[model samples]
Target chain A: MAAETKLFGKLKTAEQEHEDPKEQLMFDPRPREELNRMVMEMMTTTTKKFWLWAIGLGVGVVVLLFGAWGYMISTGMWVTGLRRPIFWGVFIVTFVFWIGISHAGTFVSAILRVFKAEFRRPFTRAAELMTTFGLAAGALYPLIHLGRVWVFYFMIPYPNARWLWVNFRSPLVWDLLAITTYLLSSTIYLYLPLVPDLAMARDRTTGIRHSAYKILALGWRGTEAEWFRLRKAIQIFAFAIIPVMFSVHTIVAWDFAVSQVAGWHSTIFGPYFIIGAILSGVSAVVTILYILRSTLKHMDYFLRPEHFDALGKLILVFSMAWAYFFFNDYLLGWYGGEAAVRQILTLHATGPAAWVWYLMLICNMAVPWLTLWNRKIRRTPWLMFIITLTINVGMFAERYTIVPLTLGHQRTPFDWGVYTPQPVEISIVLGTFCLFTFLYLITSRLIPMVPVWEVQEGQVAHTLRKIGKAEVPTVTELD
Target chain B: MAEVSIAEKWGLVVDQDRCTGCNACVVACSMENNVPFTGEDNVAFGRGTYWIYNKRMWEGEYPRVAPAFQPVMCQQCGSAPCEPVCPTFAAVHSEEEQINLQVYIRCIGTRYCANNCPYHARQFNFQDPDIPEPMNSYLNPDVTVRSKGVMEKCTFCVQRIVGGRQTASAEDRPLRDGEVTPACVAACPSGALVFGDLSDPNSRVSQMAQNERQYKLMDELGTKPKVTYLKGGGRNGG
Candidate 1:
């Protein structure tokens, strides 16, 4: 009966939709060809400014990565402000911060996908993009931190003419292995779902985009078998990658936690770091979505206030969880009456780097706690934008306190010294940002940022049935 | 068919009271194992790829937990949890030798083993190891330097075990335990750490294992690690 009515309704498709826009993002019919065309337009439409910015960033990256690093290698660690107390400085902090940012991508894409969150359909690719690029940027800090980048291979258990042994007993070696596993697995995870979208792009384009998509798409035709295999592969990866994601950050946390550093040593750090990563990372996603909507053409059609609102709910939840962990860590340390930990706490409040401490509290705790409570504020794109930016800065400050500032104050008062990075360190950080942007900007053009099939799948599963007085958006599980 | 004894329980005993936190162990471990010296920036950000860490703790204003430096590594456990959960067997435990080993070539860097591990003792190769040319020359020839995508952890010096085994065979003597020790244990000037076959009742490590202060890290999780710690010289001097 419904099928017959829907067939009859085809004659008045527009009229029926106007009468009941119950199928908002998904079922509101669109020519698959037109949607495909929009993706093509976004890719091929890069303007003069894009090229200029690209070139400028390109130039900046090479110089910063090569030039500054070259100087650090030649001069040694002294040029940087690192000393006895503040040994671990900005490099390590940036590493954690970037890794934290990377967490949002997998969490949003995988967990939400598992739960069938409809809002995740449009922005999953955008979030996934953050994972690959963010990891790439985060991975650089370890190399840069090596005062001598050239000899880093020693971490590899390789034997040469020397009869010496590569001791597998080092956590550094464990780290070397674990990160490699994560980066490759994540890249593969990011690529699996992207194949069909690439095929879609491949079919629409003519020049370079066509070739790029053709290679990436791997001749995907979305046949039942192909889709079946892709889905299976995705399922395996989703279940597999979640643990890997948790481990990657946890291992990263262990890089500090397993040791006895005042701030670094904590049994709770494994979950704590993972949670912190997700919180900051989700905020980053909000910021990215806001930028994409404001800057990219036709993004508003795809990204709506509803999406922002849904994400805001997540941010609010994550904020509360992060505070819980933060307080847990503080309460235990404060109660234990550990002198080094107290010094860290007092220094955090009234030390030389006190500004960073307050900024961290305000952005991470107060701002998110107070501002995100309002539904209108949470859903409002510009407001979310400002808040997300503030949160990132705040998270960075938090990491700074945990690392260098905490390092600055130890049991020995005489050995304490403040850490300051050289110009090289600062420039390289700029370079990493540029590299991330460069990669994201490049990716924006090639792959369809929006997963159309997912949206279509969502549409097929969704219906607006009248519930009492108002029509509520309803979804069904396609899988 | 011959019955095979896999390995005697491999363990490291850290005498915390003796550790000076002089960083000699850190440097020695890096030099012996090709650990890179990541700068303070990386270390501060928790990006340091250090496999061996020297740590200190201070508690309150007047009564601080005075500095206690400890060199912590993978506790190659009798019931190694990291081994069972690895999807690819990238990280495996040789029950024969009681070694928690990382196979870099096979490792896809899933890091699941790392997360399941309660000790937080594992590390991932976030980036390719940065070995300078001259320094690369200094790397041990026996072990295979790993690539970018793998999970790695302390193996209790497996290569050295292989070498020691070969030497023992060449001399036609049964392999005596304690012939090989990890760089961290070997480099300790204070002789605080003792490595040997825990299964063997007569070895020094075996005798030390029965001490009253013997405790495994995160013992509540039941990792059953070979490594034990004699905290603060066992106060009673056991």
Candidate 2:
């Protein structure tokens, strides 16, 4: 009996040196039903704690968003502290701010998908969810910035007694068109991949959830033709959506770029905004992934270290790219030696909100540079979460600096005024957060937030082979 | 309706040297074409609707840089980028009249056309505008109300062209070259914006386009636009 025990103990010691295949999700396949159940449980298992947070956020959003907005509409824009020189104020800052956040999903899903990045498969849905809801939230700031939300229709090109036709000549108009296209196409792009998961949910769910999934699933079945049609559609959209995504942010930048306004006029603003959007957006995804992997049960197997490692690498690259663009923009303006440009530059770094400008650098450039480079830190879900949160704060500060902060320093000092967003503006922005998280949570239960079929598909394409006495992972060209 | 040859292209030439910045054209374009008045907040953001935006650039410093007003509009380029990129045949360059036409009835608002437009001229209806009580009656019936999710841009006031054509045809005479005037052209008190047929050698626009001072905005982009501007002739920059 002692001999047998020693043999078993010896076996355990050796096995400890190697990872257990059963814990490796790819090596240990669960019954499809079991994985579905876990996802379902996470959805339905909301605690009193959840309700408390939701209600608290909801009340906060209501008071801040709707109430303050109502006040802004009734009283003029003067209520928000916006004046001539600092005309753009917090509203435009928030507009550009949310716009940067909107870039993550497309970069994660489309750009990564185009390159066949494997780790993207599981959390692409989570990222895509950010694209749709994030865009929705981002689009609202322009209208909210409008102050008179009711007469918002006047922006449309509709004909009637009012002789106003939409002037296509303005960048503001382009901002409208580009964002609308992006919001819709991204929504469609997001939904196209989600159909199968919706079908899976449709099969497992009952009552309202079943029908909700059914309608959204578009009567999908996993037949070869269904897959074929779906794949073709996705491929088309995947290629098509990238340019639209790039254009949307570019046009948003053009809202400033294509102007005689000093500091606004630059050829690089198009690519600059595009890169900025992707950088901040990916950081948001990183934060979300970290939260999900840590807070949710059974998410560890789906969200592994390898995924975080891949994301960390991307974050690092994007951080460098952002710094390059930031320096390029700064160098050109500084080199030009234009007096107006100098004033704007001075205001950005030395003004009352100068800390935000500096924090923009430390957070966007410094923090990511400092920590995300380490694989250990990148792979730590909790640490990465804090980093991503900090990145977002830094990015928001960047937008704040660009819009109101820069606006604070204009040609005429007499017209200068500091910007402060109204409580309504604050609330609505909060509501958007509540709305995004609420949608994500609800979707988690209804649809497998992780696209199981895609994961399975990847597994099918991947195999371990004996190459030179080593089990080297190889991928097949099933696609 | 059909692609007109570049040789027969229509365009406008504005003499900025003569412009007084009267803003009459701004109000006129809004009046004739149903352009919406931007609310107080949008004004602060510098996002008011204007088919023709007046740009003022300062040259020197606090005491020296003088603000010079330059009126700008869609340069309806011959190689129109906004035309071919549209997935649906919604935004098309007008071949018959050489004007870019925005078909509100057909546009799906995919906005691909807008992005490709180098001139940065295209607007989308983010929300349906609500005219105040009884203010709805003031809306022009000629223009279509843009539903949500569709692109819109200046058509060089196409409805006016149609109206002008109809009136001319009814008058029992070939349409006079100067008879059909766009709002900006008509309202220019200093005659800064001169609108006429570039196809006719005798017209003022054709002559203006030939001037040494005439230039196009972002000429390097190769839009081959119809709108032309006489070079800045004043102390605003110099």
Candidate 3:
């Protein structure tokens, strides 16, 4: 035993010696009842600050989002900075930005769940919530950016007096179908795993909260049959949602790709947009996780540095992948020898909006490549928050470059013009940001942000085995 | 025996050398189409609603330079880029006249069609027509006044086409060559603009379009534009 101790002591690296296995959420086991109580408390408890923020954001949504939209709808599209040559402005940019953010939830929850990544146990619900809200914010832009917002129903496939079907060939029609499919599938995916937890909340609460949870729980009893069905449903959705998630962004990419616009017409846009969406989405997950950890009650226990570390690695890989596609797009565009495309590419770097291009490259490529490689930086929650935020800012600039910037310069030099976002557009964009945060805040308080049963199930499967003098953490297959 | 006739395919020819850069055609088009005149600020901001405008280009160094004017309107392509991208069938082709049509009431104004137009011919009504006082009195009753949030463009003067066809049908005879002239063609002082039926082999536009110097703008795009331009340098005598 003495020799075994000496050998085990020598086997441990300096980094491993400092790292405690207990710091990992999986290794740190908590009783099922205690875990349930903690999640319930987190949902039920709200501070004065939370109400203040919710009210402020609510007012912002009404005045800035709906109010400005109402004014624009009554007046004209001239309220925005849209004119000829730059027909699509900040509205389309913000639309793509929100859609990119929505990609995070499905990617983290569905993709990681399918792979059975153990670290994804606690924060999958948080990420999944982002998917739904991000979509809610995003799907508004297609209607909001229209010149005739009231007539937006014309795009929907339904019987009309005119009997005119929407042109299925248009990419916008494809976008409508794809986004609708994604939103419905993602919402169902979010609710399926949530059923068991809603039942837990239903049991622990009474009054109005009990009634709400009771309806939402769908009468879950946690019996063996129910568990079997729930697991099977989750497994089926996890696989199904992955492709839906992929197609949503790919169809969005096609909106620009299928156009005859010189810079936007490219085959690389499909995979390029998907990679970009994932990069921005995963970064958003990290940003939200940091916010929840700092703001929510007991979120620190659920969302630890280990999760941040894992997500940081993902952001780094996606950043690299994003850079690859970006370079590939540039190389092909430059090599193709199209004069208009070459001019647009050159204008992007050297034009008046050159700062946006530089910002995109620096934040998306330079910052992540330089910083995320370091283990300490990746593991630091606060630092990850800032890096991920910067990456999102970079992604926004990238979309800005892709949309209005590219549209600003076309084959006709006589018509080339610059576009600036007007005050109304800026207000509307800020309002959507507020709306997303507001939705998340309200949702966090209503639903259990952490799936307690999933975490507890993870804990049941995880145990420390004594091998010689070492206690090695092992996971048994729960499935 | 009654004769069988093919549909009339309308065409236009612009003789650039004779185009004096005068704004008569533009003014006449605006008056005839009931196009709203946006103020100077809006015009300067690239929000002008002109369906036909001259693209002015300067040739040579400052000392040797001369101003050249190319009056660009809708090419009225045989196969237009702006048609299929529209979510609604707002931009469609006229079967009888063989011209592109912008259905004002049908346009939901996504502006996708405007973006797809390589010629930059299509214009959006950013706001309701602001023509005030006596200007509104002369508004053409034949044309539909487009409101804010819809696209409008040169229709090859479809109202005039319909009027001429109606007159001919009532009189019980084939429509005469040079009988149906668009406002811009009728208003051209130097006779630079010609409008006629290209399908009629004996029509003036058909003969003019056979000029060796005549070429369509951006013809490589395969849009098959019906408006042909005779090169501006007086290389071919008028």
Candidate 4:
């Protein structure tokens, strides 16, 4: 027995550290009750730093966004750097960029959910919230971009006193309809799935917070019939929202495509925009996931390296898709040899804005392809975050290039002019960014960031199965 | 609101050969239409709100340089790109007069029409324009002074067309051949611009439009502008 003990000690010393499969989120499951408590604790607990950051962001929104916009309203659009030829400047750019960012949430929450992507379970709400906030920020720009924000209702299709009506032929009108539809649908999409979780919070909490959750929960008792209806409704939303998501970006693409602008008037813009949306969306999700994991307590367990690795692969795929569509657009234009198109392409490639174009290529195409091809890099949270962050910057630069750069190019060389955002434009753009972040920060605390029910559902379906000498993670059809 | 049928397809012929680039027509249109005076700072940024302006280009080296000018205004295209893209239909194509109209009150100022305009003819009032002291007294009562954030372009002087049409209608006769000469055409010192009904083939503008040298700017784009330019320095005499 003494010899056996000594031998066991020697074996323990020599044992190789094999990573257990249970370390993965799916393999290592915690009870839903524990997850709810963890999320509630994180939500309820606020450090001084949190309040300071929120207040600072709130001040920024008030001063930069609302204050500047009010000033612009009274002072005039001249305060913006929107001159002739570059009539649509940073406001349009911000509008498009936020729309692109908004695309990420619907894409993940609806598309991934439709496909039954298991890694999507924990982060769908994070993505959906982005859709809501990004769109809220996006919707502001058209109003802000309007020369008279007061008469913004004129864009509404209803007949006016003079019997004048909005032109449905205009892509801008289509953009309005599509974006409004998306905003409404996505908000409902966001809130519908959140009902059960709110109910859980209602039962577990007390006082004002409990009452708030109870009202929000809509009497969700999680009964068999309720669960059945919730699943069916979510399924319907998952299917219906996918096309709406596609249409929203496609309609936005039409805003440019319908125009005769050499760079913008391309048939490929629809799909090209969709591909770009997914790339930016996935990048945003990864970045948000990284932040949640690092900052929130117990989030490390919910968001594992496995999730990062999966998202990295998805981002890589989308990056390749973006490159493909981009090339397709280029090849068609190049082959057609349209003089205006050639001139614009030359300008984009080698002009003063060439740096932006190159950065877009590197960030959206080069970085994702090069680094994401490595499994280790994909699994690294911080590295993936940096990559995604770079992608977002690249996407923003892409929108800027599309709007202002292309607007600079017209058939009349004599009238050709460039745009640079003035202080008002810059301030408003910064304000919108701060506003989106501020709303998101406050929301992340209110709603369960990790969809506990969805996560629990996923955990029920996922199991370990023997494959040869190893135990591999397998997912059964839960529904 | 009754169907007001119009026989005249009004058109313009710019004889570039006769145009010396005096920019008087620009001033005339601005005055006639009550276009606000944009400051020099706005002009430097290319935000000048001139309805009709000379598009000048310099050719050859400094010693041998010659300045060329082409007065560009709203093309009044039959298939106007700007007309269909306006979200508010503010930039509407008037089928009755065959002119492009800018309804200031209807304008929400999305600037989509301005961007769609290949000629860059449209000008947005970036700020409340001030006609310097005493000049405001001469502002045309017939024309509505545009507010800030509204886009204004050469309307082919729609007020003149309305007045001419009213006079013709009262007299119970078809409109005269050159009943409505826009401010720019009337003000041209060199007789470079001609305006008339294209439906009347005998009209001077129609004959000039058929000249071998006559060409439409960006014709390949299919905007099919009603205004035609008689090419200068060609074998065919203007």
Candidate 5:
């Protein structure tokens, strides 16, 4: 028994050399009231700087996204760089990027919850917010890219005077159904855990804020039955939404896969796109976490280096997975022996837009592989932020290469063309980015950015016990 | 009544050897179909609304170079890739005429159909038709002048086919095989283009479709294109 205890002591000291268990959010517990107050303060606190940024983003959305979209719609598709062959361009690329970003929320919240990862307590709400707003930003592109935005509803299946139904066989219809289902489900998933926090805010605030929280909280008294039902509802949605999230990106992939486009027609696209979505989505979560930590009040307590370290590990895994798919896609196309596919693959590497392809590789594959594996780098907030931001840029390049670049080259050499995005497309793309940030900014103030109740629950379940000569942190299954 | 029992199953045959690359067929089809001529910049930008355009291919290097022009229009494939992908059923196969049709009013312009078309035959109306005052009078009365934000393509001179059928029905006689030629075939100076009912095995298009040199573009794709091209090899034996 003495020898066994000594062996355990040595192992514990080795583990302690890397990280003090007390630095982890779960082990570093604060009083319930203090935690709640901190979150409420973050929500209520407003500065001139915040207003300036919000107003700036709002102006960007108005002019770049909506104004440009309206001008393009009224003037015609000619205003955009979309021409023959390159029918889908920057609009579609950014659309896919937003959808990919949205996947982060459901993945971090639902998947991590289902897996019972203790590190996911504080930042799940932040990630889930991305899913909702990312979708809002993404869902707009399908309409904005349309030739006639007025008749956009024609794609929706309804009993119309024309007595015609949308073609169910088309992948676009599937995309409409899938994205709608995902958005509704993910919003509900984000709200379920938020209810208890809202109830907490309701008890403390007055006037309009109190009334708003009261309604949003659904009159939660935090009774035993209410807690049980809330947990059960979240549990159900947690499992149910995983498939919905996967389906959303998979269907998005089918939009390209089901086409006869040379490089796009592949069976592997469904899983490849889903993996790509998760990579971008999870990287986005890290980016958002870094922003929140730096800007928001008292965020350093909830979002720690441990959380960044954990997310960095996830991003690294996803980056490797993305690389695997990228190579798999490339090799298969090269080996497929289809002349058009071969030509397209060559064009991607050596063509005018080869820089985009190289950027995709360097950012998506090389950066994460080189930097994220280091424990210090993973824990470094600003460095992880830069890496995650780079990954998203890489992801945007991936989508650009898949949509417009592939479309530009095909079987017929005479019809081959290159696409240069016009100013209108660039403005609209920037606008969606602003719209996402603006929505997030408004939502951050309106609701508890951190789920206070969840953090407290995790703290209650986590305990450090003395084992041999060292204290070891352990988590109890609260659910 | 007996003549109307069988669908026409219209087909076109292009004799590439006879085509002089003069673009007369392109001009005639544009005029007959009322296709808007986008300005020079727009045309250079690949926004030209030509229902038919000759794809010019350059063979060999500098001194040995020769340009071969292949006039490509909508093939009206029997099983078109564009039809199934269209969200609004804007691209539909006409059972009566046994050809593919684009319903202008139904198109929401997703451009998925254009992307799927192997021939790249479809054209989008990027801007409103800019026919100068006097030129507008020459626009065909039978065809609809498409506005911006809609997809248009060669309809196989569908209006002419309908008119020919009406005339034959009024006369109480079967429509002649050569009676309903598309504007392209009618205007071909070298008689390079032939249009007829392929449902009749003895039709001129059916006879030409069996020639040894006849081949469809990208036929291996199994789109089952209705248009056939006789190989052009008079100069280079290609």
Candidate 6:
């Protein structure tokens, strides 16, 4: 009996020395009111520097994006560097890059939510916001790429007096349909989870802010039935939007793949694009999460090191998947013995755009594989930020190589020409980045960046309990 | 009634053996179709709006070097990949003429059709055409000048085909096989280009298309281009 008592006492002591559950956000839960107050402070407490940056971004949008577009329209597409052999240049590349960035939101929010990955709880809103804004940024390019932006209404399917109809057989038409479905569905999905949080914001404010939140909140009293219905709707959206998300990028891939163009005609393009989208998307989410945690006060309490660690692991896994798809795509093209395919692959590796090709490898494959394997490095916020930022640069380079450089070379050597983007294209591309960031910054102030109710629910399901000689962590099925 | 009874499969046969690579056909087509003159600077930058251009390839080396010129233009394929990919119905096939017709006013300038064309035969007017001062007076009245943001290509001079058909109908006679001639065929100094109804089986282009040396460029791509080329030709001079 004395031996048993001593054993129990030793076990208890060992448990005390073990890793503290308090270190985890799930175990160390903050009061919902406290979390709300912290977020509110972050939004309300704006510094002079924030204003300066906001004004700068606003100027960038006005001058660079809109100004360049206006100039292009007034002058001609000649003001841009698009010419023979490379008709689709930087605009197309940026379009695909933005679409890939949008994928991060769906993968993190919808897919993780379906799988019940608890780490997604604190930063799902940040990821979801990316989907909505990134898509908006991406959708702009197709219209901008049009030589007759004024007559873009022709692409829209409407019964007209001229008896004209949009060609549904075109991949661009599929692209229009798929992207619209994704953008609308995702916006609704992003808004569904925000109603309860908006209700929370409404209760804690007054005056103009109060009225704004009041409308956004839809007069939610947080009834049991309201919560029940919200849960059901979110689940339906979560399941439905995943396929839409898949179709959007796949259709984009078809824009290239359906053509008999050498580098583009590949059976592997669908999965290749989806995996690439997730990789770029997850890296973007990780970068944004780190920025939020480092810059925003009291975010340290909600977005703990565990979240970064999980995201880092995801980045690493996706990096491997992207590398696999890339290799599968390249190997077939290299060995297929098609002369045009061989020439394109050769140009991609050793031609004028080879620098971008190599950078894509170093950034997407080398950096993540070497750094993410260490848990400590993944937990380190600044380091993870650099890693993710590198991944984004690499992914952008990959798209550029795929879109422009591949188009530069063709079956006939006579038409082969190199593409160099002019000033108008550069300005618009930079402007889109500023637009995305500006929208995100504004969104952070308007809504709670963290879902407080979800976090509290997560805390409820997680606890540490004693079992034999050890105290192990356990999670109960909350649903 | 006679024109309706005739099934026309319009095609071109380029006799490589007879071509002198003089580039007269290029100028003729450009003038007749009212193609935009983008000038030397734009041409250097790969924005030249030539509807039919010479694709010159140099073979051998040093003293034995030989230059071969192939007059490449819109192939007007039987199974066009560009037709299905145009978001607007700008690129469509004319069953009566057996030719690909590019509707300038309908083209929204997506450029998807241009990208899909393996031959790189399609051209886009990136800017509103400028005929300069003196060249403006020489513009063809029959063909509409293409505007910026619209794709235009060799239509086998559809205006001429229409005019010839009208004349034949007015005269109440069967249209002669050789009555319709594209500007390129008329301008060919070496009599290398033949244009006629391939469906007649007795037309000159049909007989030339059956020659042992006759082959379509990128035939294995299954585009089934109507323009046939007779192999083996060289010009000692550029």
Alpha carbon deviation, residue A456, candidate 2 (Å): 1.3
Candidate 2 Cα errors over 4 Å, as ranges: A1-28, A159-163, A465-472, B1-238
What C-alpha root-mean-square deviation, in Å, does candidate 5 show against the real structure? 4.3
Measured against the true chain A, the candidates' chain A TM-scores are 0.91, 0.91, 0.95, 0.94, 0.95, 0.94
Model 3 residue runs over 4 Å out of place are A1-14, A463-476, B1-6, B232-238
Model 6 residue B53 distance off true place after TM-score fit, in angstroms = 0.6
- Model 1 misplaced regions, further than 4 Å: A1-24, A27-29, A157-169, A465-472, B1-238
* True-vs-predicted CA distance for residue A370, candidate 3, Å: 0.8
| Model 2 agreement with the true structure over A310-393: per-residue lDDT tens digits | 788888898899889988998898888877678888778887878888999999989999998876677566777788888888
The candidate scoring highest on TM-score is: 5
Q: Which candidate's DockQ is highest?
A: 5
lDDT of 6 by residue, A403-439 (tens): 8899899899998989899999999999999899888
lDDT of 5 by residue, B130-156 (tens): 989999899999999988888999999
| Candidate RMSDs in order | 10.8, 9.6, 4.2, 4.5, 4.3, 5.0
- For candidate 2, the TM-score is 0.66
Query: Which segments of candidate 4 are over 4 A away from where they belong?
Result: A1-19, A466-472, B1-5, B59-65, B234-238
TM-score of chain B of 1: 0.89
Model 6 chain A is weakest, by summed lDDT over 10 consecutive residues, at A4-13
Candidate 4, residue B179: Cα displacement in angstroms equals 2.9
lDDT of each: 0.73, 0.71, 0.90, 0.86, 0.91, 0.88
**Model 1 chain A weakest 10-residue run by lDDT:** A1-10
Winner of 2 and 6 under TM-score? 6
Q: List the residue pairs that clash in candidate 5.
A: none
Q: Write the per-residue lDDT of candidate 4 for residues A1-479, one digit (tens) a residue.
A: 22321321332221334445565677677887788888788777777877897999999999999999999999889998888898899899889888988999998889888888878888889899999999999999989999977888888888568787888999989989999999999999999899998998898899998999999999999999999999899999989999999999999999999897778889999999999988998899899888888777778778877788888999999999999999999899888888988888888899887898999998898888889997767767888899999999999888888999888877667777788889988999999989998998898788788788988877878987789987666676677
- lDDT tens digits, residue span B161-238, model 4: 888888877777767878788999999999999998898899989998999888998999899899999865635332
Q: Model 1, range A271-387, lDDT digits (tens) per residue?
A: 888888998999999999998887677776677666777888898888888889988988888887877677777777998779988998899889988988876577568889999
